[model samples]
Target: MPIEIHQSDPQSYAVAADFLNVADVEVVSLQHEFGIFGGNAGDHILELVQRLRTPLVTTLHTVLAAPDEAQRRVMNALIRSSARLVVMAEKGRQILQTVYEVPNEQIAVIPHGVPDRPFLDPAMAKHDLGLADRTLLMTFGLLGPGKGIETAIHALPALVRNHPKLIYMVVGATHPNLVRHEGERYRDSLVALAADLGVSDHVLFVDEYLSIEDLLKYLTACDIYVSPYPNAAQITSGTLAYAVALGKAVVSTPFWHAQELLSDGCGMLFSFGEADALSTAVAQLIEDDSLRSAMRTRAYARGREMVWPSVAEQYLDVFSKVRFERRSAGAMVIPFPASVGEHDRLPPVSTTHLASLTDGVGLVQHTKFAVPDRRHGYCLDDNARALLVMSELAGLVPLTPQEDQMTLT
Candidate 1:
């Protein structure tokens, strides 16, 4: 179905409600940011969610560890109004459960999506980027306070001491929100820090926003990717996710998302805002070829689950589940097939079909020609049909005494 765009000013409640009403959307899907909830804007979203008759599915961008009263109220109300809530990480789901007391069933874990790209060797990628001699370390995002780019810069002197050919590339403009408020103070601070540390020559800042192709090029060229974000509660990091997906050896601060993704040899984690720890983590990967290769392999394997196609399928699954639940909630009948009764008058069906259709679990839902197709996965409807057929066959097959007792029990 084609979706229509309905724009509204979030700061104004009447405007938002008017746009929502005009759309008459089946599902009110929201991409929420907790920071936007600081003013009365949060209430506007909550109000819209409540007033709209449509089902709601919210993809939460920021799941705060500590929420104040208004924040909690808004988040709780959003959860109550939404048919399902989508979070990018298991840690985000856990926080919602423990902190907001949201029901487990209402929450869905869909990883932040990454573009599918063929894995390329960093050396080959670097040759293309004209940085074949440099061991590149990078972090790219719209920069602002709390990104902890300063920590990465501070760590550069030590990293440069061990590997003089290392270059730390900070690829992004100052975040628009931060620029609006602080106007490059954070970027200037980072530049000053680099200069003071005498590693100014080694740090490269590509101060332009990258297109997806450009971003992927830079990501493919890096020896190691570093996310030095300072916030422990931070739930999503697209930059880190991309690097991990591309199989770059990642060293990151222990933010919620990083801790979850980088565990068990996938990548290394250091304490938040600890430049020394960042340096050591990077040094370990730099010094050991085998260890870095292993981490890269593990990172690549784990990232396969989060590629765009897989993530899109997961989103579709959630949408299907929510749509089914909404439609079935008011339904009175189970809607079984009418042809089921005709099986009695016709000659008995051969078990050959059933035998071919059976898997270790149960009967499969789909078929390719005469053969079972398991690619679409199992369905309860098909399994239910199998159970009904088995029950009818029970009369002809006499059960032994022990078998009879087990069946009864």
Candidate 2:
């Protein structure tokens, strides 16, 4: 399906409703991080959703457990605007329902998606990465404070002593956003801490943005993937999800997303900032090969449900429900006003114009009366309208492939 990209400025809410006027656009998929901390971007998103005539599906990137009055109001407005809400964890769903008063039916729990990759043996990967005979432990992704990397580094000193052959690889560069404002302060601090702990040689910092191919190579080589993020409210971690999906044993802090993904023997989790617990979790997994292998198998099996294809299908299901509801609503005839004339009610809101406006791809957004305008592009709104009209009239009109895609969304 061909996708139309409409760019909207994040800081401005003035033109939030303009996109709603675009033709043939059936549904809007919004990614939201509800906050004013970063230039009131979330407010802009909420404004857009409020003005949208098409159905909206919002994937909330952050779900605050203890939100303030303003935050709560914004989240409530967002939930109301959205036809369906996608959260990456069940914990996030609970937070929305309990804290924000969102209906249980309004939320869909979809796991963070990961790419499908063939499982590679860690020993083979270690050899390929030139770390022969060494026990590899790793944590990766853009670096910044609150990542709890220092806690992971602090734990390393004791870990290296128990297993002399162990090497901890701190992968990826400083987070680009953090670098723009804070320079290298966080990375320098982690490096300094590793030096102070006398584990500098054991801790390898690979400071560069890794390509997906290279990242998977490094992930495949690790005996255990550690995500020592300290934030308890964190609802999603793509890095952690990727490691789990690739069949690697994981040791992570008990953040909300981790609590969900790591449950049921899929991975090990420790309390936030607990280096002793973190090290113990890693050491236990490292010592027991059978247990580690079991974790990898379980994680990989669970990950299959969250792969991109699976996630896409789940999204389609939500979109279909929204489409059906809209169609049923449109099919109902509104009561005529007391001032209505006989001529106005003669046509009975027929779908004739909608049928005339459609072509092979879908219904065009703009037209000169009943004639289709080719210059204007196909849109989700018009396509959705066409679908509703067609559905109400049964098989009198059939939806094109593009129209079908729009209605499904």
Candidate 3:
């Protein structure tokens, strides 16, 4: 169903809620970004989620380190309402725990998913694009001021002096939001900057939103991928993820996502808006074949874990767990006489499920109903706590044979 919620109209949220209630969806997966919604700090979403009849699993695209009062209020309400939360990076998980006081169990750190593409020689890809003679350096995504394309343009003059065949390709159209307000001013400024620097011949702008197939082709053709985004707080970048998964040698600024994904020699990082530094890093990668090849290999190896099939499985696991919990919570309710106190009506806890989760290594991190899911693997943090609990239980009471087996495992 394609029910639309008007961004600025508060009542549209109520209508959306009503539509979803009748849509027969067992679960709702919301892709959340603060700016995409309306009202003060996106409070409009709270109304929709509050009225939702289906279980909500929110994937947070941006997690601010420090939010203002209104943002904090809205975030807290959303967290309280959601059945589960998903963030792309560990830094976002840290912010949710320390800054928002969200519990660790509520947040799932699934990486930004990317297509699984085999590594290809850039020269062959460049031949298909009819640019085999030139060395391509590319940056893609919606064009906007925050993307810092002018910095890349400024660096081109220095780069072109040594590698005369180098061409800087700025792919994608101007961002719709930027076009709505500022019209093409940011993109024009970049073009004029390149012209002023006398490197206009070296810059190519593919001004359209590309389909996935075309985007992959462009990414494969590029010798180096550049991300000059000035913002350090950005929590996710699908383009950056795609580049890494395709085994491109990436040169990026130290944003939150880039810093984490590019660590351990996967890619090179330069300071934000530093033309000389960006130029130097790109030049080094271009000059050293062994270093560039090694970086690509490491990046491709790490990306195997982030490919679409693996990411999809992780998402399905989260959905299954949340749906089961919702159903279990609904089934636990029973009508009692008014004289019955809340404490007296509580149900006894069972260790059956706990035992099922434990294995030879440790407790599996997640489950689908009673079945343990090994896809998530075991965490040392969880194992340490399990050990502590077993130790405490042994001191207080005699361990059952089954419990002894668990401790041994």
Q: Give per-residue lDDT, candidate 2, residue 279.
A: 87
Q: In model 2, which runs have C-alpha deviations exceeding 4 angstroms?
A: 1-17, 35-38, 332-409
Write candidate 1's Cα lDDT for 226-328 as tens digits.
9988888889888889999999999998888999999988999999888999999999999999999999999998899999999989988888888778874
Task: Return the lDDT, model 2, position 103.
Answer: 89
Model 2 lDDT per residue over 300-380, tens place: 998898899998999888888877666645497577867657754434345455656666677788888777778888888
Model 3 lDDT tens row, 273-348: 9999999999999999999999999999989989999999999999999988888454775667566567654354
CA lDDT scores, all candidates in order: 0.83, 0.82, 0.91
Clashes of each: 0, 11, 0
Global CA lDDT computed for model 2: 0.82
Q: How close is candidate 3 to the true structure, as a TM-score?
A: 0.79
Name the best candidate (by lDDT): 3
- The whole-model C-alpha lDDT of candidate 3 against the native structure comes to 0.91
Clash list (residue pairs), candidate 3? none
Q: Tell me how far the alpha carbon of residue 57 in candidate 2 is from the true structure, in angstroms, after superposition.
A: 0.6
Ranking of all candidate structures by their TM-score, best first: 3, 1, 2
Task: Name the lDDT value of residue 264 in candidate 2.
Answer: 99
